[model samples]
Target: MFGKLYLIPVDLGHPSFEALFPTLNREITSTLTHFVVENQKSARRSLKLIFPEIKQGELSLLTLDKNTSELDLNPALDWLKSGKNVGVVSEAGVPSIADPGSLMVKLAHAQNIEVIPLIGPCSIFLALSASGLSGQSFVFHGYIPIDKAEKTRFIKEMEKATGRNQAQIFMETPYRNNQMLEDLLSVCKEDTLLCIACDLTLPNQYIKTQTIGKWKKLKTEDLHKRPCIFILGN
Candidate 1:
C-alpha cells in the first residue's frame, strides 16, 4: 500500500503553538520523520517550537518552494510510494495557500497517495472573517502588481468589483506593505470599506474595517514590515 501525505500548518509569527493548535496536531506531527517544506531553516525552527524534544537529525525536510518543480521532488514522491507517510509544511500558516507546496500535492495525487490536512490558521479566511466584509462572495488575488500605474489600475478593478457586494482580498510582501496601503488609499472611493488585518492570531493583532476616508485620518505607518492582508468591499 502507498503511504499518505499530511499537510501541516505552523504558527503565524506567534511562538505559542499550544494556543493555536490542538493536542492531536502535535501528536501527528511527532509521528512523521519526513516533511516537504517551503524553507528548511524556517521549517526546522517551527518544528522545534512545536515539538521541543524532537531530534533535528532524525527528520528529513525537502524544500518545496515556488521554484521547486516535479523533478526536484522525486525523492519525496518516491518516499510516499515506499509506504512512508510524509508531511508538507510551509514557513507560516497553511501550506500552499499563497505559499508553495502545491506541486508536491499534485504529484502525490497522481500517485494515488492519501492526503490528510490538519486544521490551522489561514490568514486569508481569518482576515475576511474579521473584516466584516461580504464574505459570501470574495476573491483572493494573492500579491498585487509591483508597478505603481498597474497597481492603481488593479486597485480600481478590485474596488469596482466591490459594487457587486464582493470582498476583494489581497496581500503584499511585509516590507512593501506600507506602499500598498498608500496606493489603496489614493485609489479606492471615499466611502468604500477597507480592512487591514495585520499580525493575525498574534497578541498584537490589528484588525480594523474603516472607510477609505477614515483610514486617511489615522496613522498607518505601523503596517511597515509586518505581515498584512488588505480587503476592499462596498
Candidate 2:
C-alpha cells in the first residue's frame, strides 16, 4: 500500500501553534518523517516547535517553491510509493491554497495516492468569515498586478464584480501593502466597502470593513508592513 500525503497548515505569525492549530494537528505532523516545504528554514523551525524531541537530521525535507521543477518532485512521490507518509507544509497557513503545493497534490491524485488535509487556520477563509461580505459567492484574486495601469484596471473590475453581489478578495506582499491600499482607495468608488484583515491570528491582529471614503481619512500606520487580506464588496 502507498503511504498517504498529509496537507499540513502552519500558524500565521501566531506566537504559538497551540493558539491556532488543534492538538491532533500537531500529533499528526510530528509523526511524519518526510515533508515537502516552501522554505526549509521555516519548515524545520515549525517542525521543531511541534515536536521538541525531533532530531533535525532524521527528518527528510524536499523544497517546493515557484522555481521547483516538475522533475525534481518525483523523489517525494517515490518516498510515498515506498510506504512512507509525506507531509506538505507552506511557509504559513494551509498548503496548496494560493501556495505551491498544488502541483504535488495534483500528482498524488494521478498516481492514486491518498491526500489527507489536516485542519488548521487559513487566513483567506478566516478573513472571509469575518468580512461580513457575500460569502456565498466570492472570488480570490491571489495578488494584484504590479503595474500601475494594470492594477487600476484590475481593481475597477473587481469593484464591478463586487457590485453584482460577489465579494472580491486579494492580497499583496507585506512591503507593498501600503501601495496596494493607496491604489485601492484611489481607484475604487467612495461608497464601495473594503475589508482589511491584517496580521491574522497574531497578537496584534486587526480586521475592519469600511467604505473607501472612510478609509481614506484614517491613518494606516499599522498595516504598512503587515500581512493583510483585502476584500471588496458592495
Candidate 3:
C-alpha cells in the first residue's frame, strides 16, 4: 500500500461529521505529517474544536488561497518530498469540487501520491437525494452565471439537459440565493421542479421543493443566510 494523502471534507459538520471526526483524529494522530487547508485560521479553530486532544506541534498546516485553476501547490509538493503524508481539506463540502483543493489533488495524482477520500455528508448529494429528480444521470454545473445574459443562456442549456431526464445540480453564493431563484423562475417552464436544499445538517435547515412558478410566489427574505444546494428537473 502507498502512503495516504487523505482528502477530508469538513463542510457544515453534519451529523455524519461527528462519526467521521474521531476517525479523522485517529488518522491525523497516526499518519498525518501535515495538513493543507484553504484557510489556516478556520482550520486551526476546527482542529481545536474537534480534536483538542491532539497536540498542535504534530501537524503542519499550509494555507492555500489560490483558485484551483491558478493554484501553485509548491507547499504541498514540498511536504510530500519529505516523505510525510499530507491532507487537504476545504472550509466546507468535499475539497476540490467547486473548491480550490482540486489543484493539489491533480498535482498529487501526477506525483503518484495515494489520494484517499472519507465518506461524509455532502449538501449536493443530500439535495439530489431529496430532490425527487432522476439520480441515475446528472451534471453538477457548480455555479450559474452572474451576468443576466450569460445566466439566461446557462439556464436554457440546463433546461435542455433536464428536459431529457438528466438532473441538474448547481450552487451559488449565499447572498445571491434569491436572485438565482428568481432567474430560474423566469427562465424555467411551469412544470420544472426546483429543489432548494439549504443549510443541510444544521439547525433551522430547510429543503423546499416546488415548481418554478410556485417558488416565485414565496418570499425570499424568509430564507436565512444559508449554504444552499439548488437542483432543477424538467
Once superposed on the true structure, which residue ranges of model 2 sit more than 4 Å away at CA?
A: none
Which wins on lDDT, candidate 2 or candidate 3? 2
Candidate 2 lDDT over residue span 1-234, tens digit each: 999999988878775867777888878877889999999999888777666777789989999999998798999999999999999989988998888899999999999999999888899999999999999999999998999999999999999999789999999998899888888988999999999999989888899999999999998656778999999998
lDDT, residue 149, candidate 1? 91
Residues 1-234, model 3: lDDT tens digits = 344578776747544436445466445634565888898877665555555565677678877656434345676777776677777777776677777687777778887888887655567887899888879999999877899999999998998898789999999888888778778888899878888888787776788788877787777534435788888886
| Model 1 TM-score on a 0 to 1 scale | 0.97
Question: Which candidate would rank higher by TM-score, 1 or 2?
Answer: 1
Task: Report each candidate's C-alpha RMSD, comma-separated, in the order given.
Answer: 1.1, 1.1, 2.8
Better of 1 and 3 by lDDT: 1
Predictions in order: lDDT: 0.91, 0.90, 0.75
* Candidate 2 colliding pairs: none
Ten contiguous residues minimizing lDDT sum, candidate 2: 11-20
Full candidate order by TM-score, most accurate first: 1, 2, 3
Residue-level lDDT tens digits of model 1 in 6-95: 998899989888777777788988888999999999999988877888899999988998888889999999899998899999999899
